[model samples]
Target: MSGPITLRTQKALVTRYKNSLATAIVQGASVLANEESPKMLAIEATALRETAALVEKALENFTKTADGMEEITEEQDKQIQAYVEEVQAVVANAETLLIRIGAKRTGLQEATPMDEGRRPTVTKKTIVELPEIPIPTFDGKITDSENFWALFDASVHSQDLTGLQKFNYLLKALKGSAREAIKRYPITEANYAAAVELLHSKFGDKDKLIRSLQTRKETASARNSQLTEQRRLLDYLFALVTQLEQNGIVLNGSFVAQKILAKFQPDLQRRLLKQRVVQGNSEELWAVKQLLTDLDTLIKTEEQVSEMLPENEAFRGGTKGRPPPRRYETTSGQRSQMRQNLCIYCSDTEHNSLRCPKVDSARNRREFLKEHKLCINCGKPNHISRECLRSGCTLCDGDKHHFSLCPKRLPTALSSAGPTKSAYTKSSRTTQQPKRADAKQPTSSAKTGAHCINSENK
Candidate 1:
């Protein structure tokens, strides 16, 4: 009784409170109403007072029971909080009705004399006004049904309100398809229950909820390779598994562990394996729970490595002055086209054949482009070099060729194409004609000394 309560026990307590309140409301409906005769109203007043006292006692006991339980798992804590909020709403609504009934009974007693009694005396009781509880709305999402219905039931459905009143509240609280579904049922007192049943049948199906959770589980394991993604994936899986288990769907630990590992990148999968989550050489069983710890450690280590890289030059050994290359950009339409065509050289989807790293060297790339009958200027098919409209050879400002395969940037460029020009070209657009060689040639002594200095420096 002092320790943490089991889920079964908590559910039973909520069920008991709901059943009791429902029975009380149903049995005392006539007496709880405002249109009773003075004598009958006196009898009804006694019943209403007894019912109110019982409700107040029940609420106090419910609160004490919750407070007595020790703190446990996060899921348990959430359930407890939901239970408290739900029950509090129900009790507050019930108390509001009870106070109204009491006021009506008091007015009846003062207005109408009781049989063989002097003019009835009214005993005033202090009433504490309750703050309005905001009701949650539903937008036809299956995932939202659980939360939406819990608050809906506590504040509206199970309250002392009439069916027509509840129906109005229901209509106000729904939107999208949820409202449309209930709109078919006219807002009559009789149709309220039917509308509630219809919504519960459609969106509140237990099987649908379980399937949705399963779909999310599968998605969590699909290509979530980055540290941030993996961390979020693990946390999501933990909550997902907890929810599935709560619904009596137990997953196979080994199967789930293997499935998740198989979906990771090969290097990441190997690192996880090295953590000894999977034991035995041939018939290994995966410890699914241990995966969370290993994955967390891997994420932390990766973040640490990334943080240290900028500060430690030895760890980031690459070009010193040049910045890293910018990632290739493509519009959505271009990406769609690329997906259809792929890289003509290596069949890669991310880039065109001209940008393929596999077709190394300017000579090979140009050969591939020519052999495929693609435009040498832009590397796209269907047009000749001159006919192609794209500007050409950004590397050397040469005409009729792409910068990607420009011979100027290639060290092994063919000698027939002449010595590779300086990668640094003049920014000026004006063409300067070659100067006539009117000056005398340099002295043989000066040329020899310059050549000697260059050779010695090398």
Candidate 2:
């Protein structure tokens, strides 16, 4: 009709029985050896017999109940087995003590019943001391409250403390509003549970706690402050995630990764997204670590570049909201200098090489040739000047006189315009004069012609 005994209850009962039996046996042995009176020895032996009977009855009940129980878990089975072994060992010791004290065995079997010379020696057990639990303290601050409650709750549940003891420890950890809230309650074991319930009712608002973890946004100004906003955002997110987890809101790695990425600016988000794509199936923790590392490296590189540049040139290109001033003074000075050194052919300083004039002339000449189709030598398009094979005076294209002796070769505008007309007149005049006079006149004309030709060449 009765339910199965819990491991805790069974262990407690077994421990108590062992302690009582050991105490009674030690007392009986001490009285029998030290006391000269048979009356005292008999009285101690009687007490020992009663204690042994109690232990034996309890062991019998435990064994019957443990054996009858079905559907026992491994942990329960181990507990029951350990309890039985301990009880049996205690009973054996009690029997040996009874035999030594010259008392009758209380319905318990002994291994060496006939050997009365074999005496049992009690060995002192080595007690292992456990380390003390550290108590957490909490102020009214939300951050402190969260950390303290987690540790405090774990410690209270794990330790074998009474209700009053738990309440006292809780009070010792509280401060400010939390401590004040429960101060009016009487400090009694009966009121401990009520006090805890009242404290929770007063302060525990899940919605408010959840709302406190609102997403924080970084400002544009904060960007110039060397990642101050980013650091703040990261800390807030980590705390928010931890708080959410504590509240039993389980989030997956991808979901957390998305949440973290969402908090970043558009540029940073895009960069991190690209990185994630490259990495392929990275977890939230790894993504965050890699993101932070990249940001740090980028910041360091920028700082190094900025350091390398001259202070005046470092911020020369103004940022988004502002435009750099136009440097008119330096620009105007450079323009004036360029104008002074401008090319004679093109009237531009951009062209300073010998090829520039040649290129300009060739382009113009080609255009002219294409339009008029004229040759430089005979005013005909049959061939170019270089391929002209007509046999005549080299200077004027005349057969009457050699090119050097041509009288029309003068440094005059008319000569430059049309030398053929002047050549005809000079040739006719040379023919009309006498041969003797003509020879003398031709010498002066020849010298004059040579001088004019040299001047034209220059």
**RMSD list, candidates in order:** 23.7, 38.1
Which candidate ranks first by TM-score, i.e. highest?
Answer: 1
Let me know the TM-score candidate 2 reaches against the reference structure. 0.32
Deviation in Å, model 2, residue 274 alpha carbon: 3.0
lDDT by residue for model 2 (1-458), tens:
32464534655676787799988877777775676454565567678777866775666566656666777789987776666656656665665555445432221223224476644431111122245467787666554556666788887635565554566567667777987787566444566788778666666666656555433212212333223355455555555656766876555566655655665445555665686679785565454434545655544454577568763333211133233666664677796676445432233344431222322233333333334444433333433444333344555654432222233442332233333222112234445321221233447889999999999999
Name the 10 consecutive residues with the lowest summed lDDT in model 2.
121-130
TM-scores for every predicted model? 0.37, 0.32
How far is 370's C-alpha from truth in model 1 (Å)? Answer: 26
**TM-score attained by model 1:** 0.37
Note the Cα lDDT for every prediction shown. 0.61, 0.53
Clash number by candidate, in order? 0, 0
Candidate 2, residue 203: Cα displacement in angstroms equals 2.4
Q: Which candidate has the highest lDDT of all?
A: 1
